[model samples]
Target: MALSLVHFPSEVWNHIFQYLSAADKFSVRASCRYFRKLIDHWSLWKNWTIVLSFKNGPYNSEFWDSLRRRKVSSVVMRNTKTKDWSRLSLALPTLTTVIMDQNSNGNLNFIQDFSHLNRLAIRSSAVLLDLHTQTQLQHLTHLSMCNVLFPNKSNWSFLNLLPFLSSLTSVVCHNTNSFGQRDRMVDTLVSILPKLKHLSLSAKYISPQRDGSIFKPVTSLSSLELIDCLDHSSPEDVGQMISGLKCLRVFFKHSHQGRPEALSASVIYLKTWLSESAQLSNLTVVKGPPVRMYATSIPATITNLTLCVSGLSPRDMAAVAQQVPDLLHLHIDAWPSHLGAHTARIPELFPKLRSLKLRQDHVPEKDFLRLQQLQDLECLEILDRGHWSDLYKKLQTLTRNRLRVVTSSPQRDAFHCPCVSQVY
Candidate 1:
């Protein structure tokens, strides 16, 4: 007698269904009812995200019922113009994540309908948030807004409502045009959102209040990122804002329009803070040119350091090595004329370095080969692939196949291994 798929128990069929892609699973379901039942199991749909379009009309009852039956927990709304959110809320009460993008005619009042929503992202949309309804989203833990507009309110007034959602742990606001009174807005958020742990903001400029007072510290915040948002502020002001945060473990500051003098001043303040911070383990500074001046201020507690600047020289590298002897990860994105001359000394400089990423340094193959001397090195990434051939195999042979080499664009080869492990 021949054994057939039906002869296997449903448990085995369900296990097999997990390995199949959604399209393949649907194809298998079409073949027999047994497979169809197994394919419809909620476990298979647990990780699926449904994309819905409201440009035409609301989905029919059968479509909504199917989503509910499958236990769909996430949905992405595109081209949304619907006002019939009550029906959606009643149909898919299990939704925990909602993303609204490219929507122009929708109001955020619908967010109150999803009682279980934990994450919400709004992008490229102009919408109104009903302040009364926002307080009802008690379960929302993460909120992200990008290029969003709330025409009825004053600049960044939506931020004032964040205190009502007590469960929020993370918030990101980027690329919005209404950034007036940033100092007051940020001050209010940090003071009110006691549970907030992560915050990222992008703006044209970030400075202290008109009264010359710096940002207040928040004990709960562990990670902070400011993007393209520094200018004219005194180093003392920047230092005060960062040093006040007692729990900050990770900090990233990137700016494209910042003045050279202001950026250098900011780095000087960062050096003072870095020397005193016992909890700050990861740091990134971009578009600054005076890293060498403050390299000695880096404390040994920092295990991860990233510098994206134009003034990183061989002497600066040596200074960083001397300061942070236990540094485990280092990334330098610079094109200094003499960096390649000092490449051979890296192993001697950072003996315990586990990962190294270099961009546009143009080190020679022989100098690159000297990196094999790092006994603990696990990964080496090079952005400029001009000077080496068969370098990956050579390094693997030297390290007994323990090291992973990634060349060219990091994005294209990110999966080769862990791509620059996060500080957290």
Candidate 2:
């Protein structure tokens, strides 16, 4: 018998409704008064992430405003327009994550509302009139701040930004090379953000000052990263800093402002510290140079390692194959370091490895023989730069080995971006 939609229980109907997008969910609610009541009873629409457009198109802030009339609490705007942020309806004080960033341009503005906000993300140069950067944000846990500029006000210092975010646990902040004076900005950050477990901060020339008063270390820090550390500190000082973290996750990468050689030295000392530091089991190093310089440097107890090198070249693969024995998982963004130089020579080295993930740049070619050698391959994704032409061949290869399922997505403009998604 064909069942009518009316006979389904609210719980069952909700399960079906959860799959719909916020816009589609609203459309369903608008079909009738009963839907409005039912949707209003659901919290799915209470938090929203909408991209604001300053250019004033069909899907701009006004569009979001219309949706706001339905009662959305949180909003995450990506690649937003200046006007969209300048023209918010202020009905969204309930928002927890707010991202107004992109190639758009507009004068930054301050928010005087948000009495119920817990977390916030801003991607403009606007100075936050931070009641504390976070206070009264009782439920706030993660904050992503990017492209934020200093207003030259005596009142708005970095340390001043943190007392308000008393509840923040994770943060990802990026500063443009053209940003405020490097040392001053970094000094402001290190002195602030008192309590943190996961933090990703990039800076230029952050040499630990002689006067401990100038740079007070945050003792509660657990996972610390100095990504793109541009001429920040001497190799010795950096090793000292890493040693201070009782438990940590550190990532140091190459940058335009500093010498690659200096970054390499820091990586070596970091590798040393990881080996000696007690109670530190998680260690990851990438992007500086050959792993041979530091692979054996990793603590033998380390259980997780990710390498972001260009390709699975011999030295790179060999370093991993010989060094890490207690490793639990491996993720590699595989690309051709040299078309026929290194990787082609070493196909049979990684025999003891457990889990492997081969992420392609744009092509859909599998290093088939490499897959056959791994003892275990848990997750595989065929990421297509545009579209897959040889889906069947790849699928047949996967089915032949009885490997676990894989996930994929074709090349598209608005795909999942870890940087933009999390960098508030």
Candidate 3:
């Protein structure tokens, strides 16, 4: 009953190899000449996502040079040292997108002549590049920096650097610290980047003061995300900020702490504000521990709602049903233990929901299988941690593909569902 690997065609072998990790592929290549030739096929490695780390010893420049010859387009460098950068740039001049995670002591010399680079991301690192380097990166259209700090010695200001990038359209800065001019940076970004349509930033950086000069409305902005930055004490101030964006269609708010009083007040104030805004369509809350916000009524324009909460109760389910009766898509955090015997009963709460996403670390099989009771659910997304494989197999067998099973990464995956018409 042994299967012959040599009997299969190269196409079939290539398809099988696709699922293997890069190290596994290299190991497989060493097995024989045919396998080595198959691995060397340029079509298999042209669009590679290589993860380089200093922990693995110095990166082999010759191997990277081979990848460059094969035209590898995407790379994710993690925990990279300053010395390896020079070799990386020389190795991959054709790269279009680069993600640097925890890169220590970065400099501009590495990326000075990356003419094809369009998207760049930096996370959890304090890297500094001069204004001259920033100005030369005119081809960059999308830039994302999270939990990153800019060094004071660079004498470079993000507020001033952003204005000159004419090709930039989308920017996301999450928990990013700019020396002393956070207010001015936010105010000037819109005017500087005429092509900017989507923006996400930490709310704390935005000036709470309502200075007309500083807080000008960005009419061209279609999407906005404020992460854990809302003033917990001032619901009215947050409401006022939301009121100015008449063209805003997608809004995402991630609250750090869900103090009952602060959250409830903000929810109540936002209900009134959202009701008046006709253009707003999709609303997603990254985290709300209470799972229930006491809004007077949900906005009629809001057809999509996604919430990531610590826990959920029957009362929370009832509250959402009453508030967002017209909602077509509903996603929430669900814990198996929290649901207990109430799993099947909760599906009836969202009478109009066509799509539902349950996010959890683990799921009791019986509780999850009970979702078959949801008659209106056309799509079901299970966003979970490492324990999802068994549940996925069970759900597939039980649902028989009647419910569209959408899959995504466990980290805030519900928000990235493409089957849902509206997303942020």
lDDT at 370, model 2: 44
1-424 per-residue lDDT for model 1 (tens digits): 2368478888888888887777787798788766666777888876677777766777798677667767988777777655555666888876888888788746777877787888887878887656564565667888877778877653335655666878888777776644564545445556777788777666333445566554555456676665553434323343344543333322234432335656555665556656656566777766544567677777677788887666566777888888887889877766543366578888998899899987535667788788899999998887566455477688789899899876654322111111122321
State candidate 2's TM-score. 0.66
Give RMSD to native, each candidate. Answer: 6.4, 6.4, 5.3
User: Candidate 1 lDDT (Cα, whole model)?
Assistant: 0.66
Model 3, residue 392: C-alpha shift (Å): 5.6
lDDT of 2 by residue, 278-305 (tens): 4455554445555555666766555555
Query: 169-200 in candidate 3: lDDT tens per residue?
Result: 87877776763543643455677888877776
Q: Rank the candidates by lDDT, best first.
A: 1, 3, 2
Model 1 alpha-carbon miss at residue 334, Å: 2.1
- Would you estimate the TM-scores of all the predictions? 0.71, 0.66, 0.76
Consecutive 10-residue window with the lowest summed lDDT within model 3: 412-421
Best of the two (1, 3) by lDDT: 1
